[model samples]
Target: MSFIRIGFPSLQQFCVNALVAVSLLVGGVAHAEGGPATAQDGERVIKLAAAADKDPLAVMSSAEGRWFQKWADDVSDYQFGPDKGVFWFHNGVAKGDLMRVLRFHHTVTTAAFQWQKKIKDPRLNPADDDAKTLAGVEGLLRAYEVLVAKNPENRVAKIDDLIAIRNKGGLADFVKAMPPMPSR
Candidate 1:
């Protein structure tokens, strides 16, 4: 869909498309089956979110000013869903199943990134700014925890790294990268 296109070439076109796209995207809501978490979906959600960030207008986080709260809600929805054991690509998924994960995660991460940007906009920011960003980072950490549990291998997503990028504190505070993983 045109709404899925991130980094549109022109700003004017982007703004117009974003306005129309947001409504269309949210118009439909697929009820969650509350099935078990799958490793494949976990990995896919983070990946899609990252890709969507390239163009802010493509998702709710960028277009919707109050996106962080919505993202917090999303985290809860997935976090508390019926505890089905995890699965990676090893199992299977329906067509476009991954797309839903992508849409959801991308919107969430984009919202967090935007908030991180807002509070840290100025180099000499206030302590409150760091606090706000950290709060957002914490939510992401929890979300990632559940995702990583699905398959630690997917930890390569280095989600903590994204949060660290926003923190930009000394390396001491930067989230560590995943340790070397063994080949399957």
Candidate 2:
């Protein structure tokens, strides 16, 4: 076999092309409701992203968006990160709602992007992100409470269970009984 050496210019061009292809592939990596993002939903987000002063929450009304939020709540073990240190997709999946759904949309797509990009430049600072994280938890709680309070059909059981757990000992006890996050 003969060995062929590629010049620096050729190798650099190859690298650039490879990165573009990988980016396109990663664009479809996000999932919703146990399935991948629908093609129409993807197109809508692309359009919204290009629009000036567009509301990201508008995407939450999309088909994939609604499903993803529910999926985030349903799947306690759902996460995106490396083995040791990484971004937690739904660190507290217990609380959820329309607002939380929109927030999760922002987290997984616009803010975090793909897994590789999210890991490189995570939105939350591991060292000093406690306040923001706590704020987010509180926000989810409020959203969930409001959703449950409005006589939402599907949310009553979840809220009731949470209340029951809280009544038992508190959120602390409830969380202590939660299964550990699955390995990435």
Candidate 3:
């Protein structure tokens, strides 16, 4: 007797659909395993981010950034399957520094706007105030130079790691730091 072969498109579709459903179920369960971040933890993360942004030079000079970079690189090597998650965590952390930079820019802009408003005020000297603002901006730029000199790849690397952390739990920490929303 000759061997018989069977090819069924409907059967293949059923198998595919079953696999998709099972995968989604398992993924949802795995994601639900991690608990939410506490408010204290969130605040700590926010503070770390703010501090890094405020004085990147200081952070680069300290042992912390060096240690963290090494740790992150080490993690990158061993955890091949979770690479995306780790990178996301790093990116989230890096965004904190960027947020600080944006805040600094806003501060300077606000100061300039105030100076302009008081330009003609008898008590306020717009020129002197403007000079101080420019000085502050120059100082920040210098700090950035120092930071980059110490860790040339820091900003990008940190960002990648933070993104991974966010995907895992770092983003939750940020949200917890935010004031609670009022009930509708």
Candidate 4:
């Protein structure tokens, strides 16, 4: 019997590391209730989040916005094929960023459950070694839920927090940290 050794790092580990880095960068008490400025920043935050949420291929195809589009394409490249495992890992990081945006949206503006539901997509459900990674995403969701429930004004803060995090460190480090695939 031939054993297939998958030397790659599990998605959960990648999520943990990515989340830890995010937490370190955006230090603050996970407040249940956000401050009042959440509403004012809601629109700006949403636009940024929406931009980030664009389809990777569409972003890559944009001729006029090549620089920004390339960034999205690079992210998509990590999520498919032999790189799938790495995709799951960075999914955790993306989830963390998305959670921050969602919290900002819910807290500062009207309560909208759409973003929350999207994050809970069954596709993200963890399995086997993926359980821990899924849990990390869940943790981010829980934080957003609490923020929304408490402040309903954290929308802007969350957006600002996410932007800062992304600028400080793009997703590249997380992508590089993933375990490499075995040579055929």
Clashes of each: 4, 0, 24, 8
Candidates in order have lDDT scores of 0.36, 0.37, 0.35, 0.32
Give the better candidate number (2 or 4) by lDDT: 2
Query: For model 2, how big is the CA root-mean-square deviation?
Result: 18.7
Candidate 2 lDDT, 84-129, residue by residue in tens: 1112324443334443442543333432222223233223454223
Best by lDDT: 2
Give lDDT: candidate 1, residue 50.
45
Better of 2 and 3 by TM-score: 2
Q: Check candidate 1 and list the clashing pairs.
A: 36-84, 39-87, 40-88, 49-106
Name the lDDT value of residue 100 in candidate 2. 46
Q: TM-score for all predictions?
A: 0.26, 0.30, 0.24, 0.19
Given candidate 3, what's the lDDT at residue 90?
A: 33
Q: Summarize candidate 1's per-residue lDDT along 1-184 as a digit string, tens digits.
A: 3232222256775676565445533543322344432334344334334434343323334433233334334442232110011112112321132333333443355334434344223124434333433433343444444444443533533444554655676422331221212334
Candidate 1 residue runs with Cα over 4 Å from true position? 1-8, 11-32, 61-107, 110-184
Model 3 stretches with alpha carbons more than 4 Å out: 1-95, 98-123, 154-184
Writing each residue's lDDT as its tens digit, candidate 3 over 24-137 gives 233332211123423332233233333444444334333433432332234221111111222223335434554344234323322223233432221145354443333333
